[model samples]
Structures are given as C-alpha cells and as structure tokens.
Target: MPRRSGGLRSGTHYKLRIKSRDKGAHNIAKQLQDFKKEDIVMIRTIANCHSGMPNSRFLGKQGKIVGKKGRCYAVSVLDGSKAKIVVAHPVHLQKLGGLAVQISKTNEGVV
Candidate 1:
C-alpha cells in the first residue's frame, strides 16, 4: 500500500454537498453575477461544476477581487502570511458584506 496524494477536493464531501431541499435548479442571477475590482468576496465552490473551480483549501475563505479573466475573476486571498491569487467562476463566489471594514480596522490597530 502507498500513501495517496491529496488533490484539490481530497476531503470535502460535506462541505460542498447541497441539501436536498436546496437542490433544484441553479439560480441565473448567481451564474451571471458581476463583481468589480477590489470587491470583497467569499470563495464558495459549486458542488457539481468544476470549471474554473479554485483549490479546496480556499473554500469559504474571503478574498479581494483583483480583476476578471474571461468569465472567471481573479481573487487574491491571504493564506497565512502569503498572498495567493485564485481564478474562479462567478458561480463559485459570493459577495460578502461588512467583513472588509473589520479587516481594515484590525490592520490599522483600531480594533
């Protein structure tokens, strides 16, 4: 037997599964959502759609939008002390509110 190499979705069944009640049709608004540069957004991987999907580690993490690459957007997220950029489709991203203010405040030593 040999050790298995963990991939992008190595251990994320529960985290990405959609509830039966919530599983019907994909929302058009979500699929066509638009984001602007510098916008704070959360990485939410689509369960079935793997196109332009980011790494599983970035799931549920918040990041700032850098730019748009075709139908996908470039998001910059801080993993520990390093800043990494991830390209993901709009369906895999959700706009987050208010958390940006708190993050800036903490960085400025105001909180």
Candidate 2:
C-alpha cells in the first residue's frame, strides 16, 4: 500500500488566512446571504468558516448560481470546456453586480 501524503489544502496556508482585526468576527449578513437561481457569484473562501468550501484552485472563479443545497448554493463554473458545479456556503459566495440574472433552468443541486 502507498503511504498517505499531503492533504487537500496542504499548500494553502496564505490563501486561507483572515485579517488580524477580522479574526473570530463572523459576518452574520454574509453567512445568511440569499442567492437566487441564475445569479452570478464569486467563490471566496472564509477562513473562519470551514464548512462547504470549494477547491482552493477554484478560488476567485466566478460562476452561475444553479440552485440550493441545504444552506449552500450550487455554482456552475467552467473547468476548461467542461462545466463543473461547486457547492459552497453562502458566506463564501459574493453576488456579482448585486442583481439577479435571468437564465434557463439549471440542474437543481449543489456539489
């Protein structure tokens, strides 16, 4: 058997750090943000909240909101030519343009 090595977030020490002043301060509004279907959203990781985070490589990638999964949202993004859905918490999603988008129906699920 092969020995286990690095974990999924092994090299993301800097990518997941919160500012000193913002440490331990939870943004209640963001944590309870509401995202509508077809809206555009950006994936930004919140170090304080470790739940439902997408892959680090997907950080800063923008995608369309497909649906909701529990308290998280389903975001559809393009990985090369293939489309991928990344499920993340609302705190990690920043709505783009602060407006709802009108698009076709999408598969109702999150990663």
Candidate 3:
C-alpha cells in the first residue's frame, strides 16, 4: 500500500521514520541532527535531566513545534508544569505524533 502523510495510522506516528543513516540523528541536544524544517516531532521527556545549564531550569518538559531557528528548532513546551519556548535540535525529538494543525492544500496552491 502507498504511504500516507497526514492523519492517523497504525505504524509510526512521526512525520517520517528515520533510516539506518538517521540513527544518530537523536543522540543529544548538541550533536542533534536529522528532521527537516517544519517537520513536527515529539521530544522524549527528560525525566532525570534536571541539573545544570538550560536543563537546570527547564527539564522534564514536552516541547511543542513552533518552527526552526538556524540549526535549532524553536519549541514551545508545557510539561504540565511550566511552558516556555526553547531552541532544540532534531535529535531531541522521537517523532511521537503529527501536528494537530495541518497546512491547507488550498493555501499551498495545490489543486
């Protein structure tokens, strides 16, 4: 069967699955990689990452997709505790679900 882009499915909930070459795409925040611009993703919550640097202030939170800024993705997160916009890389995401909001085909000039 052909692959579908939007809506819900039984397989991966991400926009796209990472290939073998994309394994290391999600290792750390600094060495983060993969994922294209505007790609909606789900970042795994850092449970035990509450100390030092940015993590010291904002850990254990699920970030939201806003957009990208340079190599880092601008994220707006609300861990059910606090909400803020932070810059993160693709490696920080695990592709849990699709964006609740999808771009309209008409807006994209599709017919």
Candidate that scores best on lDDT: 1
Global lDDT of each model? 0.83, 0.81, 0.46
Worst 10 residues of 2 by lDDT: 102-111
The candidate 1 region of ten consecutive residues with least summed lDDT is 102-111
In the range 48-92, model 3's lDDT, one tens digit per residue, is 232211332333344445777776677665544455676755545
Instruction: At residue 11, give the lDDT of candidate 1.
Output: 89
Which scores greater on TM-score, model 1 or model 2? 1
- lDDT (Cα, tens digit) per residue for candidate 1, span 5-97: 887777888888887876778777988999988788889987877688888889888878889999999998878777889999999999887
lDDT of 2 by residue, 7-102 (tens): 988888999888888788788999989988878888999888888988888898878888999998999987765689999999899987733333
Rank list by TM-score: 1, 2, 3
TM-score, one value per model: 0.83, 0.80, 0.38
Error of 2 at 96 (Å): 0.9
- Model 1 / residue 3 / CA error / Å: 3.8
Which structure is stronger by lDDT: 1 or 2?
1
Q: In model 3, which regions exceed 4 Å deviation?
A: 1-40, 44-60, 79-82, 98-111
